[model samples]
Target: MSHKKALEAFYHKLRNLRGNTRFVGGSLILFSGDFRQTLLVIPRSTPTDELNPYLNSSVLWRHLHKLTLKTNMRVQQQRDASAGNFAKQLMDIGNEWIQIDESSNVSPCHQTSVRSLKA
Candidate 1:
């Protein structure tokens, strides 16, 4: 899934829990994501649309409190297309990059070639 879509999913989760939360004076909100996407989740009285924050990094960093997970996970692969093959690729870049791969046969969920990224 795209990072924006994933953020929307998280937003939906929080919207689901709205009734369960009781606000005495302040609210507790936790958002964790890539620097760009996390900024979209900031709670404001006037709600922002889903696509706005991703387009503006300034808005994102302005609202960001912390950033983590700087390292990339890397792995090697032989030519294969079984479930294990999917797992190997997924481990490297996660499902998001799968969507971005340009090959016709290789999809985010199923890929069929060696993909390497520099550390």
Candidate 2:
């Protein structure tokens, strides 16, 4: 199946089984593996750029109160790449938040935190 179709089907099934009482809460953590290296039960090859944001903004992310981990279960090479990309993406998002806050005249505590981040 094409990546888009597979994702659609996955979401459909998730929606169907969402309130089946087997699962605990509204959170659904979907982990996609490297196309070159299979990690989880789901298909091994999907475009990360296309799905990363969807995963981040999905019900799981929105509902979950905390994010304990975001680690790749693949081997060293894929793990390193995923980790680096994840870290950079997080930092960029944080910086964007700081920029937005600065434009709005952030509170003193937030300003201090931003300065510490810059350092």
Candidate 3:
């Protein structure tokens, strides 16, 4: 994921170019990404350092419309029971619906491709 500063810089540049500082040159600029997935890569940095540069951390975040998608394409398109179950588990993990212990570890309830995705 790109840093929030980079996006802000682009916004400023757009303002200078179009003379419209309203928001991204008064043009709609769509930023799409799954925050549950990977985030800013700050080498040898702590969790706080990594989060500080995220788009969500920026002042501009509050201005953008947030949309949440609920569909799981794997479960819908494949029409397989196992795939659906796996997808649900993955979603649960992402949404923090499944609780983790104080030890900061989660037990696998069933087989899933999350580990494979790490690879």
- Once superposed on the true structure, which residue ranges of model 1 sit more than 4 Å away at CA? 20-62, 68-119
Residue 26 lDDT in candidate 2: 44
Top-scoring candidate (lDDT) = 3
lDDT of 3 by residue, 41-114 (tens): 77999999978987889988888898888888757998899998898898898777997678877878898564
Residues 53-81, candidate 1, lDDT per residue (tens digit)?
45232332343356556334332233345
| 2 versus 3: better TM-score goes to | 3
Q: Which is superior by lDDT, 1 or 3?
A: 3
- Candidate 2 vs candidate 3: the lDDT winner is 3
Question: Clashing residue pairs in candidate 3, if any?
Answer: none
* Tens digits of lDDT, candidate 2, 1-119: 13444554665676677755333324455554433323233466577554543434355345434433344344335657767777667656745643454467745664433345563
CA lDDT of 85 in candidate 1?
63
For candidate 2, what is the lDDT? 0.49
